[model samples]
Target: MSNESPLIQSMRTAVAAAPADVPLRLHLAELLLGEGLGEAAVAEAAVALQHAPGDAGARALMMRAMGLPTPADDKAEKAEKPEEPAAPGPSAGFDWAAAENEVAGAVPPRFVTPARAAGPGVGAPEAPLAADGSGDPGDATAWEVDTPGSVTLADVGGMQEIKERLEAAFLAPMRNPELGRLYGKSLRGGLLMYGPPGCGKTFIARAVAGELGASFMSVSINDVLDMWMGNSERNMHEVFETARRQAPCVLFLDEVDALGAKRSRMQHGGMRNTVNQLLTELDGVGGANEGVFVLAATNVPWDVDIALRRPGRLDRTLLVLPPDAPAREAILRYHLRDRPIESVDLGKLVKVTEDLSGADLAHVCESASERALLDSTRTGVVRMINMKDLLGAAKEVRPSTDPWFASARNVAMFANEGGMYDELLAYLKRKRKL
Candidate 1:
């Protein structure tokens, strides 16, 4: 905790106080590199590059921090063609090249390749190394599977109702197999989480995986779709098959509405076939899915195929609303944990962000940090993020969920067949949106 010298600490404080100060950030990065803190130096350099991508000093410092040689020609080229000035904001200006190089060694390849490849006249055709499918036998690399994370329901702050519902609908059955069997409760169905965008549906899905101590594989439309005929269906099959192989796995289908949209409304036969393949996989036609748990999430559940919601598939639904007061406070605190913030009235801030989703809360924090950084940069006086900055940002950020709720209102009121969206309806009514 006390390993850093006083000067290093002071530099960190200054950088946090004036995040837009490219020279100061570069200087801090240089100091960290001199102190043998390579990783820390790389992080500082990365931030500096984001603020000023064309800075020669920052670029050289980044190369040194990463233990890479800075070529003379590369430096000359950088000088000749300066990078475009990034957007003016705290979280703007992502330096993709620097970021990729920084994590190139640490992160594994997205797809696995065969060791030996056939000559020019390859057997048939080289398999596509798409993120969704590499077509390698028994290779699950195509669909990134995260190990059981440490984030459990306990880590999800102020969602007591969500935790309890999850326990009753999903977690309890998995936890007590004997009890479930005694009560004729079959673990053959999946849970569908539906709500406005920016809620923590995906996070909750991951938490469910963590609770079950299972591997987590998240699939989205982009991960499944392919231009070639039938490739999409194959990708979907591969995804489920990978989950089956990695028994005790949670296969999370993000944006299920897009993947399983109503077949009647589909203009393409391929998407219909993809949905059919998904249904087959969910039914485990080829192999038993005994230990594979399915969790799907969507913002517009009404658009999902009706057949997918039938019994023994994604039959159960849970509505995830915006963060409550306590949840908002927790989210704000987490976002501000590393920033140079002082005298923040979290309780007051929470009261003002009543309908803000988790993402919106993050934006508020970013905006507040930007204000403080810009103010410091203009006035030449470094300062910590104060309550005024936070409150102003909160006032500026309209709740992003408002539009989602607006669209959902008509659906919840009119098309709630079989009371599928009763939870949503109740929420709208309570909020006086009905």
Candidate 2:
């Protein structure tokens, strides 16, 4: 009873007043140890250590109060004994007060937000990017499909204007920080990348992250859907939390309509609930503001929630379309950049690829290369792709946008006042190229 001095009593009183203040406890514990009150020191230090196991100073007080050697000396002694391992008990609980720098290494089967409950690292709850569409951690390593940076603007075919816009929006500002400040705009929040399928929507999203030196976290519709409403809300909150921590990062979403279909069309309670919850989490201040961006790609841009497209949410929408002739030619050079081509004229080839999308041209070039290299031990090699091989490939593969172009042409033709499809007049003129 005499061991309880006035100073120790004061320390206990202060700690009692703010029991949740882990930092204050550690400070009291360290002060007690400094004054040689080892017994009282150990008690305070032990309790403080419970809140934050990683604090080296608090840990040292515990060791001194327990009448044990310093941690360094103890580890050294243990190292001297080749046969014995240190009896370091299982880790105590983790302290989320210092929630920064905590990384959730791998995907968990299901995730719970760390704000309300302490759990292992979360893969970031914000933008779920699972392509197979399950969205959750079904497979152990099911987060992002392709690594960032691999798909450069050059890697993507066509969409040069879109590329130019992205370069100005994301790249130029990031690569030149001072210049960004001078221009008075920092890259933050959301950029909606919407386009047709296989037109490099996903590629451009990933490339933006890569070009900006940001981490990529993705989420899809399937990942956010929960049988229970409250669970989904919590999950959405957790995601934005994780995303802010992993700042200067891109949250890419593919086929976003699946997750953010027009709210008006949602028939089920689950769908509407999830969309509203998502809108709040993304558009609200509950999420981080600095360098945490959302890039959602969908074919059905018309179906995306309007709230998402409003000013601050997913404000910037870039329409990714099929490559025009010059773009198609660039795309051809890119896909065929590694492969060897015969004395076929690129200008002539470009002319023949009129009305074909970048994806369509890629398929044609790929088939041509495969056919050219099929005879030798060159499995999948393209040593000498000739004009005949390319023409043959054109016959084998069909244009993806043929039907769309036809409809567009008819619409433009009927709508035009002059006897011409004013908008598609250029494309109509190029019909002879194909």
Candidate 3:
């Protein structure tokens, strides 16, 4: 359906095959700009710049795409000789700062300085900067921490068994410090929620944070890993330090498998060191992690490092499954709440979407609305979403959880070591997956 010429499409395919080829990518960007696709050209040029940050061709193309003057244009202007003896300002050596501002929209600056102005006072203090001319030291301005949200476990739709287990194994001790002290229960451990994708693991983590009246800071691999030597470990340590500073903070580690993958299987020494740093933080090496609560979620718990799950780490494991019947109905209702709908049979829809995850239920609602929109567009008559459209979408979209469970079936059957995957195995057996 694309109206692009065959040559452009072929170049795109070649660029995809060799994404690191900066020249080829620049050529594609030039072609896109010629076709009047300014936005698309900017995107291609930006990607080429990423591959080769110092490439002159990529920078020129990006400037052209953004309708800004390139370095060559600046050079030409300087060579023409000014009429009034070039002002006694900066030297004629390419004003890089001005050029950066010109293409600021297309390429963002790598670092930012706090913008401030001195007040008209005698003793006004100037803003501080780091030794390297960046922001102030110990400034965790990059990481975002959300205040305690209102989404408690009660707001969570269903999965009653999961709730009960969470309350007994995790929340009860933290909620009653006196009882925990009497019972010799240490409030120092973490919980690892493992399940198929899109099963609301991160949502449950946030809800737990809300229940504890704690701030939430979520960290993932991208937030921790750095290409520079020893920086990844430093980043990981900073994440925990920030959580400790904002005590009564829930440090939710999304996709923990990538951050703490099994060290034995890891091929990179940097990654292994990063995992070691994570272990050190969890153990509260330099400072006490008294008010910090750690909650991690992963689709593949088996891939996480063993050191991370040893006694005092993420010892407790919770299996999050797909939405049950009540959950499906709630999810359907929530998604349909704002949409124009007529006679949505929640009970029947729940029955049809038995094993669908929360995300799948959302997709069903979206697909049904899309169908109604398409019909209205074709017939030139507006219509509300009906049961027929909902049913048709449900029939068309197969359960995305199927493939996840298919792989989980083999793991549950063969790799339920230390009874870690007992909950998953039991669910698989009940579902006759084994």
Q: What TM-score does candidate 2 reach?
A: 0.54
Residue-level lDDT of model 1, residues 399-431, one tens digit each, is 999999999999888888999988888888899
Name model 1 segments beyond 4 Å from true. 1-141
Q: What is the TM-score of each candidate against the true structure?
A: 0.70, 0.54, 0.68
Off by over 4 Å in 2: 1-159, 169-187, 226-235, 337-341, 369-384, 403-434
Q: Order the candidate numbers by TM-score, best to worst.
A: 1, 3, 2
Best candidate, TM-score: 1
Range of the 10 consecutive residues with the lowest summed lDDT in candidate 3:
128-137
- Which ten contiguous residues of candidate 2 have the minimum total lDDT? 131-140
Model 2: lDDT equals: 0.63
Candidate 2's residue-wise lDDT over 1-434, tens digit each? 36666776787789999986888887787777677776666667656655664678876666666666896888999889789666765586556544433443432212122244456874332321211111112211224333344444554444557778887765676677677678876556677775445566665666677677777777776556678757766666666666666777777766777777787887887777777877876764643556777888876655677788777788776766666665665666656655766565566677787656666777887788657644221231214567788878877776786665555555555554333234244545656421
Model 1, residue 222: distance off in Å is 1.5
